[model samples]
Target chain A: MIGRVMDAGPGEPPIWVMRRRATAWTTPQRRYYQLVAALPPLRDFRRTRVLPMSQRRLEERLALLHPEDLADLRMAVSLVSWRRQPINRTTAEIAAMYEECMAATRNRALRSTVEFRMNVRTVMVALRLKRLGRGVPSGRWGVGNYTRTIESRWTDPEFGLAAVFPWIPEARVFLDQGDATGLESLLMGLLWTKLSQVADRHPFGFEQVFAFAFKWDILHRWLSYDAQKARRRFDKLVLEATSEYQDIFA
Target chain B: MESLVLTTGWMGIFSPLALGAIGSMIGVGRGGLAAAGAMLEVEAGYGRFVGVAAMPSSQTIYGIVVMLTLNRPVSVANSPGLFVLGVLTGVALLISALAQGTACAASISASKSKAEVFGISIAPAAVIEGFAVFVFVFALVLAGSIPR
Candidate 1:
């Protein structure tokens, strides 16, 4: 899958293609002033207890996007989303998906945003592999530009890229201590910061919209982890299950 | 060459109105789109959004006044002055209107979410308008000395 993705076609690199397409099609001149203004500001994920905008409302607002942009955004989201991957999907399939997403995304900011998330995922994978005392497997085990560096520098504590990724040491500590929740929180915080910067740099533009959507996703995911809510949902499910059995016995 | 310069003077005299109108059209369009979008999310206070959208319209008025002020006979002497002043004023108004429209759209979008910020959010647009007024006032004052 990695070989297929790398040699998909002969032409410009994906990054260069993305840059050229972005300049030609996704110039900042196309402002969504009304759409942007209509959406509410998203609070930081860590600080947000309740999502300011519901998923339905967000979808409704997103409907205002140009059809092409909406399509691009959907494709990008599917690729970069932190949602659990399907159990059956092979690593090669995931790699192919990432390649497809990068090729199709026309916006530079959006493409780079996806790249950033993928790089983070790659780094996390490397860390996990290291923690497991495993050697870097051949072929594309991860995405982004750092795959080669990670493979070669697998023994380095920070994979010899500590300066590039300042949070590696902290993330390493979390991983070492088996602090899964802490590591997740740190990763989300890093992405949140990146999205915030993107939104700030491109206010009232497509980049801002993409950033908001991703940030909203993060906030929604964080808020759904309430123990009380989970307990209530668990109880409701159990009650429903028991009621079915009761009816059968009756 | 002389005819061309005079013709340029005439073009300059009308440039403000034409350019200012174009700027206002875009500016107002931006603000109006934001206002309309905000209306979907909001229940009341729609009037204020419309009012904010109209902020960019002031540039057109300034353009009209500049056009009138620069409306003197087009001679070689006054042609240069008219051309310089009219074209420059139009450009300024055009840019300011475009910028203010963006500011107004931002204000409307922000204020719609947090009602408290409605008043304060417009400060940036107001500041941009202040700059437009400076261009307007100075253009008028300078028009008096343009070999009219």
Candidate 2:
């Protein structure tokens, strides 16, 4: 779909907007802007290889990196100081530490963006648990207004998720059918919507950068999980958006 | 003495033109670069970004107007008035144009990522343009009161 948009010539009523929406970023572009700026030389060096390689080839290389190799890769790309200390930690523990570090960031914009993203992830988890008919472990849900929002929607029959998320109907359909993959995709869509809202609301400053970077992550995850499905979704989105544009132009 | 007075008059007339040229150059240059960069990311709305970039060029037009309004012969007495008015107004236009360019650039960047707020995003740039307009109008009005 992106290829189709890229190949689209002039006289098109800008159907490329939706195609631009789902960009993939290997690193958190905004979060590490300063670091990247500091390592311009390294970036320029890597761009020679990274920009020319196919997405699959790049992923293949990334998949083969060891943790120490990952640390080296980070250093090579970002010039950030790294250590190869032999300490064992579970994914949850690492995530907790990351959340702690993100909370500790002095930049208020970065902090809020991280919080919002974590909150969305937590909401997805909570919804998944609800779908599985399992109870949410106490004190485990992440912070943000979304925690309350999801909890209210789950516990109160009258509180419709559709009030906050217009796409809730589609999500609910997936949930009803017990299509976990579909639900996950819908959850990711909801996340992009929320992030775009935040970015639009705070358009002038750091939030724009944060939104772009995070959306890139979503595109990356979607593409990696299922490239064919991602392509189909993109094609559908392009068709829908193009029709809307045509209506306006007409 | 006559030549010196005549030269001062020429300078007075040229001051706004020179200042305005520099102001508009920086203002338009900055805004144009930003708009171009933004266009790379955005799929459409080229007209909107380009329009915002043109905001800085108004300062130049204002400067030319002020020059025409100060069209009288330079004299010992009126030279001081022309100098003050032309220089101060030119400076105001310059600063306003530059600041407005920055504001426009920021707004363009915001809209590149989120296109829904394109209309409202340019509000800050418009506000900055308002300041430039205020200076332009004030200078034109005040130039009339200066002794010819």
Candidate 3:
């Protein structure tokens, strides 16, 4: 099934193609014994209120990575990071970004991590569109290998992917109930588990370093989700939205 | 054929020291890198990390001892026994040193963050050293019977 999708063309290559390419590249195994030893261990995001190592300290240790590996790591992180993308980016633009990032990433584990993240994001978007009563989106509506599977199985509750992604039903419940925090927490938890698996496979290698950095990002994001801070930001946005209208009425 | 057998005997005698030193160099390098890295994360207890890094060096000592025990005159009668025992001991010591180095590095990395686990974390490396000692002792006992 995946091969059929890849044979279609470069314009709409499946996610598995990225995996195949990543394997073919075979990034040289460089041990970062000193770097791995220097960095403090990271606990699961749910288990900690404070980050074991600060961003500055982590970056200091990451500086020991080979220059090419460091660049690849940064590129992979930027591609997956929600904050790094502008809100106004079109589907085509996002698709292009994915293509460029996947092409440039040499590490197999990092590429797989990025691929996993984008697939999750694509699924979430499909769910959101369904909730809004939008029809099966056409012409590059989202990024990842599952775009076609999602569209063809638009009516299926789990898009025929329940076996591969068991959390989809639970995510749908969160979406329907409008529990944004619950949904966000679920996504982070899943990513954290995935990063852990990746780290275990590539100990003392660049893949492990990337996994640590990605986990730190998740921890940082999770800790920053203060209700009071979010409420303040919400109010500020509301005030800005209505400020111009208020002047016109007066 | 006689000269070849003598040459083989000589090679076997020095194999333990040569192989053990090579293994020690790699093993120590791995542990030392980890120790140096750990130093960046911890303020005190620097001595323990350095100490653990030196754990693989014992293999070189074992190798030297085995070499001395097998250093008898090379002859057709005893050459085969010397060759087998010395080479076998060297290979065992080499493998043990390499494995122990990785264990030591892992222990150092773990203990640096949670200092309480320091004592227990080195247990694996200690177990590996015990295996090297087994080979060392048996090699000595066997060398005495090699018609020296």
Candidate 4:
């Protein structure tokens, strides 16, 4: 029904075609393999060479890609490889490396998403390190130029946690109170807010679909952790968002 | 009487209105469904979604204007002018409305969650409206040259 409504004039491209074109610019092959590795059932696999979303599917889908594409694919495989678990990389370092990998894809929306996630992750890790009274390794942040900004503000009392992510100040309160559940919920909410903005800014592109997929993944992980808790948290977040909307619209 | 109606160019008089109605109906219909879907996800801030959904309605207004501009008594002499301008302008409006509807739908869906994007998301629909305006202005300009 939605499809019929969206299909307009003869010249208008179909939604599926738009989706393909939008998503084609991103590292879809790498994303697909990452998803495969993230799946609990598949995580134990030493290699995903035999996975349906892996080599064969990638080759078939991206037959036009040059050798560089294959090289990128190999890099992704190495990153997701089970052996990499033994590496002593910090969360910030891992995130930075992943973001650097995504930057190579040359998709604007994907790059924005990676950069946004990197900033959020960097803040979270810095906060954790601060709470432990450890020094923040400013050099580890993966987002290129922003690393220096993050470093300077790493321990700046006034310009710390809440200042970095102005959109979700509640995150600071949750973190300060040691409310693990609230912090997790707030983090997801903040991420959703960014994803929603991306979807809005690029309505005709793959960002909307990516936002939905990212939300679904977060929700799924939350549910797996504790279904009842996750549901309650989600309902609360929606209520908060709705109330904020009402406040503005009223 | 039928022969008089033909010679008098009733087709020229009604052409814009008929095409306008068809175009607006399809355009609004497309955007309306999207607005409904959007409201399902976020009940608040519905006014903006509805506004975006109504973007295609401008085509109908353009159609009405063209109809009025071409409203001179249809004689064999002026009938061809009316027929060509009215029909072509109507077609342009029709195509523009249909395209605008799709953009409006996308806007509504996107703005449901991110209310801040309501303003920016409407840009694509507004761009589509520009094409409709070009048709409207050109039709009016061309109508001035038509003989009475």
Q: What ranking of all candidate models by lDDT puts the best one first?
A: 1, 3, 4, 2
Docking class of 4: incorrect
Which docking class does model 1 fall in?
Answer: medium
Candidates 2 and 3, the one with greater TM-score:
3
Model 2 DockQ, alpha carbons vs. true complex: 0.04
- For candidate 4, give the lDDT of residue A29: 29
User: Residues B46-75, candidate 4, lDDT per residue (tens digit)?
Assistant: 777667777788888888888888888777
Candidate 3, residues A109-201, lDDT tens digits: the string is 787889899889888888998999988788667776787788899999899989888999999999999998899889999989999998888
Docking verdict class for candidate 3: high
Which number leads on TM-score? 1
Q: Order the candidates by TM-score, highest first.
A: 1, 3, 2, 4
Segments in model 2 whose C-alpha atoms lie over 4 Å from true places: A1-95, A104-109, A139-173, A201-206, A224-250, B1-26, B35-61, B64-138
Q: What ranges in model 3 sit over 4 Å off? A: A1-26, A82-84, A227-250, B1-6, B76-80
- lDDT of the structure predicted as candidate 4: 0.61
* Candidate that beats the other on lDDT, 1 or 2, i.e. the better one: 1
DockQ values of all predictions:
0.77, 0.04, 0.86, 0.03
Interface RMSD of each: 1.0, 8.6, 0.5, 13.2
lDDT of 1 by residue, A1-250 (tens): 1333434256756554655555665454568987888788787777777888888999999998998799999998887776667899877887877777877767878888898898898889889888898886577678777887887898898998998999999999999999877888999999899988988898789988989899888777777766557889999999999999999999
Q: After superposition, how far is residue A236 of candidate 1 from its true place, in Å?
A: 11
lDDT per residue (tens digit) for residues B6-118 in model 2: 67666767677778778788777766766776665556778887787788888888889989998897778787678788888778888888777767776666676677877
Please tell me what DockQ candidate 1 reaches: 0.77
